[model samples]
Target chain A: MSTVTKVSSRYERDKELFLRYAAIIESSDDAIVGKTLEGIITDWNPGAQRVFGYSPDEVIGKSVLILFPPERMEEEMDILGRVAKGERVENYETVRVRKDGKRIDMSVTVSPIRDSSGRIVGASKIARDITESKLLHASVLEAERHFRETLDHMLEGCQIIGFDFRYLYINDAAATHGRHSKKALLGRKMMEAYPGIEETEMFAFLRKCMENRIAQRLENRFDYGDGTFSWFNLSMEPVPEGTFILSVDITNEKKLQVELEKHRDHLQEIVNERTAQLQEANRELESFSYSVSHDLRAPLRHINGFVELLQKKLPSSIDKECLRYLHVISSASSEMGHLIDKLLDFSRVNRASINKSDVDVGSLVRQVIASLAEEAPGRSVDWQVEKLPDVYGDQAMLRQVFINLLSNALKYTGTRTTAKIKVRSISGKGEDIFVVEDNGVGFDMRYVSKLFGVFQRLHSNDEFEGTGIGLANVRRIIERHGGRTWAEGKVNEGASFYFSIPRFIEQRG
Target chain B: MITRLGRILLADDSRNDVELMLLALGHFNLANEVDVVRDGAEAVDYLYRGGKYAERGGQNPALMLLDLKMPKVNGIEVLRTVKNDPLLQTIPVVVLTSSREESDMVSSYELGANAFVVKPVDFHEFIESVKNLGFFWAIVNEPPPVSRNGGEQLEG
Candidate 1:
């Protein structure tokens, strides 16, 4: 309890604390060293030996410059200059060299060591190897570059906006699609850059997505004030800061859709107008058929009837000339009547409702040939009929077609002593083409165009007695069944009539 | 040699058609029993014993040859009236006309017409058809007895 005894005990306690601090520094994982203001190594701990690869004896009197790499030698001086001025250099990251001559990244802290008199003597430095953290930082910077490059090369327009509606980032596509430069858009308000975008539906959708933290998609047309417009499909999603947007150009597709709709409307209008006109024409044709069947035939019957009465009343009193005149009148009236009947048949082919069924073409042709044979009893005609395929059409209309064609064949072949008619069928494009060829007095090829015209006759009545409406009737009937009729002939050689009908495919239920 | 069974009623609007029909009937000496009316109204009156022949008729005609196209009423209307009447329905109604329209033929059949014949444009064919019709209706086919009290009469 004396004053001197107390001071000596305090001194012993201070030495005990210093030894404990020394033990702690020696067991640390970091390097701890004591050096002088002149940059000489004074003390080195076990951690310093482990990090610098040097033992305490090897580095106790060496200059600290031995641990500095040649390129970082000035770093030691700069650190020492600050430490000698009683300033602590904290986290002075630089490169250093090991005893084995390998270099490593290090983070160092240097503090001015003080004596018992409070005067700076040397410095105590702590260092840590930071090579892993340095490599991690470099990799992080490389990934950021890759992400920016990927955004720049995307085809779809991408843009990132801040909460203040300013463009934080705009990809290359977004800048080009918006018809503006990236330099002009970045860090600029979106409304200021596009001017009219604030009033657009795309802007509204983007704002809604941002406010509600949701995603939205919209299509809008941007009119450029010049006569040009562009359509865009915009997809917007709420991000952390504001909204992220992706835009795709759909101008061409939208234009094509609009044009197709317009064409469809135009076609519908044309079909309606054509149907109305066809209905009107059918009404007129019906009235014409009615008049021809009744009023016209009545007059002709009266003419023939009166002539017959005149002949019956005064057969013996009538002179030969008068009788001959009466015969002409009667024959002419009968001819007119025949013409009217054939005309009505032709018109009926147009007006009648087509009842479709499978028709046997071969049997129909045979029946027609037999009727023609009965009409021309004395003619020696050789008929060659092929095995015809069944067709789907109106049976009666097809029968009429065959009747007219066969009758024409029999009549034209009257000049030949042995008339030969060949009936055959060949398959055509999507149809069956039936040919009726005859070795007859063929018509001139110049008048072939008029063959299917009503009242158009090639030969005079004296040569071949006909009303000249048979082929016309044949054409009308075939046309009603969605078929076509045509002829091929040469003068005095032979003639062939050809008609085509669509092939029928069986329908499945 | 033609039997005078019953009166034949001929309804035609065309004068020439009527004259021809009369001549055709005269060929068989059956014209005396035949009575001609100008239009369908007269035909209806003659059958009903109204208008002109109310006092002159003995009984309803045995056969009526109705022309389709007439001025006041058509052949179809006259056929409809006669076929619906129980008293007059026994008479055989034949439609003879210039029209060969399918609608006319279908309507005639639907209205219970006994026969439909188109007048031929050929005079000889017309005469032959008329002769056959007159001979068959007047001489071959039996006629119903006269209805005297506007009631259906059982035929003997």
Candidate 2:
């Protein structure tokens, strides 16, 4: 009887311990409940109520289908059948409806309950609320999707390589640059995937980045496999255990640089050709000058020598009339010598090199007039020179042009009573056109064509003491200044000589 | 001392210039005398009393005026020959040529010629230059005593 009483007390203590464990499971956050194998809800704890939005009163004796979503009813029945067959389902997470009709994520553990006779009578299920964990996972997946979309749409190619140089991820831009699909690129080694780029600057830069464990950038060219080359500015950044690269096409910039270099080479070639031509012309001019100095002087000396001889050797018995005639011959020959010298100087102007600078044309013209007036002091000549425009040209050359024109006007008009000479400027066709007009023995219109030719004189030698080289020199000077010269005249009337200079010629020279 | 009316030798290539020079020299009869040679070779032969000039020469002329441009031998060679010969060096040689170039004048003077005269173009000027040349060289000037080989060998 005492043994029976002790066993009863031990049984009471064990029963009390089991009741305490049951209360702990009920009051804990985890949903602990017991159910019949026939798919009925036999018990519901507070955690179960919280997970399924149902109380024990509302859930007990009802089918467990009340806690499942409508779409998951079949799956719930299959699960219940499996539990009745003595199968325990552990950590079965599924969607359950709350009391507010909201779908919540729950993990369920269903185990078969057995009596001391070893027969399964019912099942106990532990349900835990896992909605927070599920929300975190969904948010992470959304973020990854957004990142992939952004990278794929970028203009620059983006690539991610593993520590072993295998492609972990590549955006659409990178796939297009490699001329392949993203699926083909994944899990492929960089060298095997893009064999051409393996030994290129791109590979070298990537290797450097890997070695240094820092970011690196390089500009290099790549063959596009279509007979064309593309330039790229590649930036490689070393990430933890991997490298990320961005590439921008710089082919257009490289093309522009090549074009500029070609242009420079072409310009240099032109300059070199022009310089050679100028040097050749200068050599010819020096020889020409040498010929002029040596050859032309010989004839003048002969003319002077013969004249002097004739004057000295004439017999005293010769007629006074004949002696006077001999004197005329000697004077004419001297005059001819002077003319030849002037002609030589005129031809030399062609060999002159132009040097452009600011020139005071007004003062130069006044000086010419003053000098001419002094030369012909006896003649009453009115010199009217207008305010001249400041010009940019070879000062000595421009002075020569004006001097020739003025002197010609003065010389031709010597016969006129109170000879009137005028120097003036007028605007014409974006040029400064200067005119030297004279009221004197004018040239015929027919003879105007021959005016600027070497030794082409319109008037007879008796009428003028000129070598006829003046106008020709004037023409050459104006032409060398990038200008033109012309004359208008009628016999016995006045003559006007005009010349113009282009504005750009000054700046260009 | 021998008088100043001794002969003057003028070597020229041009007929016109020789004619003119003779007319100028005609005025000076007593104090100065003029003799003309056609070319540089003839001038040298006449100075050495050889060739056509060997027969009737009495004495060497007082002075020799030589023209530059000529056929056969040119001016510098003549001047070089005259200056190199010790016998002819004492006889003053004047270069009277139409070449008025400074280089010609400098070279002639440097080659031991006494004077270089550029003939003038006008006839009156030529006469004046010739008159002055005769007056200065014949009347006013004095010549060094003739060398043994320089003066003419008077045959008589």
Candidate 3:
């Protein structure tokens, strides 16, 4: 009876130890599960309920295969069969589904739970949820792959150098720029690859960028020492390793710039030579003009003077026809003399250096009209002068232009009973165009091209008196002021002469 | 006889020019007192009382009519000599030439020429111009007294 009582107390102590172990298993953070050898769930703790989103009552008799993905169902069989055969599976990683259908990456450790007979009947598994840590690891690997892809496909030469002047990473373009293979260049010092690289201009820039942690740029010619050189535009920025370099080749563009500069210099030489020749010709023209003025007029003066003396001396003895012939001779000589003076004036207009200033053309027109008052009384001349802008030009020359144009307008309109002359000007882009329109005897359009030529006249001397040098001088003065001249006319109807003066002159040294 | 004017100097190269000038001035009988020289050298000699004028014995002729483009010396040189000299500078100088060049006019005026007259090719205008200047200078205008130093006198 005493032996029976002692065995009962020991049995009670064993029951208490079993209850404490069960309580520790219920509160474990990891899911602790129990299953039969047939892959059916036998026991599920509170940890299992929290991990799989299921209660113990719901999965106590359920098939453990439900927790496996359909594609990995065979994994359950293999793992459980190994456990039944008494093999311990520790930290086996696999994919499993929760009750809410969210998949998780898990680390599982399985052991055989045997009966007292030392035979495996069920398996005890402890699993850890590793989804967040696994995703973080995968994303880091993805970022590394993306960085390699971006640097490998770049067209500009991109390279990263380490602290010892070694190539840590080099792309395909960087490899081609150095004329070396990427496999042979990486992890190798640039000085070892290219023998004299340290002495190069680009090397100094790279060294400075590495030491000072500052960025630098260079368009330098790198000589490969085989009598061949290439121009490179290199940019270097300090990086955590050593230096990051980017380079683009511009050898052809530099060559084109050199060629263009040489061509422009050659063109300048030609322009200088041509200008010298033109100056020489102008000097000759000046001397010729001087000769015409001094030598040619003296004889004509003598001829006219003697003719006048002959007329005065032989007045009573000479017949009327003879006196008339004498008169014609005198007139012809003076006319020729007048022509010489006009020719000299035309020549001098081109040769004289222009004095440019702001000139009020309206006042100049009024002054010319006042001078023309001597030619005033014969005809009823109606002049309509518009308000004109002040133009930059030689006042005396521009005054001569108005003198010629206005006088021609007045003279050519001699036949009109009521002469109407209008001096109108309109502002244009970078210029002002002035029109001297008149209701006068206009010229034939067929002969209009000859209007501004020296000694070119449209009307006979009996019809209208002109030396024809007036329009030519006008054209010369306008052209010298950076302007142009043209005209429109119809025979016996009217004529409109147009001349333009620039509002602004482009400065030249 | 009330002689109206003093002797006037006429310097020209061409004999025809001298004849025409005489013809123009002879209308009013003003040619009687005009002393003609064939070139600028003789004109200079007559004014300086040297060379052919070594026997000259009168105040430098009443006026000098200088012609440009002479053979030996030019009107500009002759004018330079007369206007630069103290004794001859008092006489008036007129440049009567065939050249209407602006440069010639500028040089003449710059050299202290009293008047510049471009001889007209028209004989009637030539006669009118010569008559006007001749009448004004020889008769109407009076000459400075025989004072050697007649430039701008320093004011006290």
lDDT of each: 0.87, 0.79, 0.88
Interface RMSD of each: 0.6, 4.7, 0.7
Model 3 CAPRI rating: medium
lDDT of 3 by residue, A312-397 (tens): 78849778899889889999998999999999999989888999988899999889977885777878888899998889999999
> Higher-lDDT candidate among 1 and 2?
1
Off by over 4 Å in 2: A1-158, A161-216, A221-232, A238-242, A248-267, A303-350, A353-358, A425-435, A441-468, A478-509, B1-156
Clashing pairs in 2: A53-A99, A304-B121, A307-B121, A308-B121, A308-B122, A311-B123, A312-B123, B60-B152
Q: Residue by residue across A1-509, what tens digits does model 2's lDDT show?
A: 99999999999999999999878977889878788877788878887876666789998998877777899989766777787788999999888887788988888898998889978888898888889988899889989889888998898999888878899878888787777899998999987877776777678788888888889978878776678777888899998858998988777899999999999999999999999999888877665654454445445445556666666688778899888886676677667655655655765677656888878899999987888788988998888988888788898988888888988998888889989999999977768999999999897898778999988888788778678788888888898888999999888799999999877653754
What is the TM-score, restricted to chain A, for candidate 2? Answer: 0.59
How do the candidates rank by lDDT, highest first?
3, 1, 2
Best of the two (1, 2) by TM-score? 1
Ranking of all candidate structures by their TM-score, best first: 3, 1, 2
TM-score of chain A of each: 0.64, 0.59, 0.78
Q: Give per-residue CA lDDT, model 1, range A142-179, as digits (tens).
A: 89999889998798899998878999989998887888
The candidates' DockQ values read 0.66, 0.15, 0.63
lDDT of each residue in B1-156, candidate 2, tens digit only: 234546788888777677667777666652236777888898878877778987736566667778877778777778888888876787677788765445568789899998888665555677678777876776678777663245643333
Say which prediction, candidate 1 or candidate 3, comes out ahead on TM-score: 3
Taking all chains together, the TM-score of candidate 1 against the true structure is: 0.68
